[model samples]
Target: MNILLAVLTSAIAVGGTLIGSWSTYLFQRRTAERAEAVNREERLRQERLAAFSTYAAAVTELKRGLITLWFRRRRALRDQDTREELQAAQLDSDRLGAAAEAAAFRLRLVADDPGLRPLMTAISTHLGAISHAADRQAVIAIEARFEEAVTAFIDAAAARVQ
Candidate 1:
């Protein structure tokens, strides 16, 4: 009888120990998973903010270019300052496009929204047209299109920003 009681007690103790170990393991796993999930969310938020900064910088440059080009389009000798601004804007646009176009530019930004490309292309085309215009009408066309494209891009980017 004593032998039977001893074996039964030992068996119960071993079973309890196993249950305790399993519970502890599950608890630790859950905690780790929660921490990992929080980290991921934080990383994503930072990435978005970075991307926003890049896009905002690019848009500001683009607006400056548009202003310069528009104001100088009718001038007999294109303003040297405006020309410089155009060049700077172009460089900023390229840099932003590289990132807005991909993942690397964001403070850690992501997403591949292709709709933004057309606005950039339009701005470039219109700006280029101004340089090659043979007459006032041609210049006007460039002015109109450039403004339109810039406005559209700004609107879109603003929407995305908010």
Candidate 2:
């Protein structure tokens, strides 16, 4: 009878140890999964932030280039030397436009907010209008709208990333 009692006690202890170990393993696995999820979210936020900022900078540069090209082309009509300057400005404008387009594509890929796409496109359309603006007043008007579109995009992006 004593030997049987001893065997039963040992079996109970072994069973208890197994239960404890299993519980601990489950807890640790859950914690690790939570941590991994948080890390993934942070990484996505960072990528979105980088892509948005890059796109904004690229578009702003393109806007400036377009305005400069517009003014230079106007001057070229009156001055011979300005024609050479106009060509250089045209080249610069083309490069900036390409960079802005590439940045737009990157932004589109990373952007979670659906509203941002139209704002991005609006800025592009604004820049195009500026390139063909009939007068300084027209360019100035488009510039204001361009700024508004950019600001809207930024606000939407900020809300999304947070």
Candidate 3:
């Protein structure tokens, strides 16, 4: 009888230990899963912010490039070389427009400011007018106007953001 009692107690002790270990394993697995989920969410948010920043930077670069080219060409430039550089700048501006549209749609960047859309439209129109001009003289006449418009845009954009 004593031997039988000892055997039963030993078996119960082993069973209890196994149950405790399984419970601990399950708890650890759940905690790890929760942590992974949180990490995934954080990474996704950061990716979105990064994408928005890239789009904004591209747009700024386009404006800066066009403005810089305008300034460079403004200084007693000959008709032939000025026209060539203007064409190149226009192409860069067009690419930036496409990127802006994509970013706005994909990232839902429709901000409260009404001027942003019009500014973009104006830039596109200015470039288009320059591109369609029949002669260098026509384009050269509007070069200063184009430069002023872009400068104003930058100023207004800064104010609006603030």
Q: What is the C-alpha lDDT of each candidate?
A: 0.62, 0.90, 0.62
Question: How many clashes would you count in candidate 1?
Answer: 1
- Per-residue CA lDDT of candidate 2, range 81-159, in tens? 4566888999999999899989888887877467787888798889989977899999999999999999998898888
> What is the Cα-based TM-score of model 3?
0.54
RMSD, model 2, all Cα superposed?
A: 1.7
Give the winner by TM-score. Answer: 2
Candidate 1 local lDDT, 86-121, one digit each (tens): 566556655644644343244223634577667666
TM-score, candidate 1, is 0.50
lDDT of 1 at 152: 86
**Model 3 weakest 10-residue run by lDDT:** 104-113
Steric clash pairs (candidate 2)? none
Q: Tens digits of per-residue lDDT for model 3 on 1-162?
A: 999999999999999999999999999999999999989877766655554455455555654555545554553255545666676766776676677667656544534346656665565566556545545576665555556665666666555434
Better of 2 and 3 by TM-score: 2
Model 2 off-target regions past 4 Å? 80-82
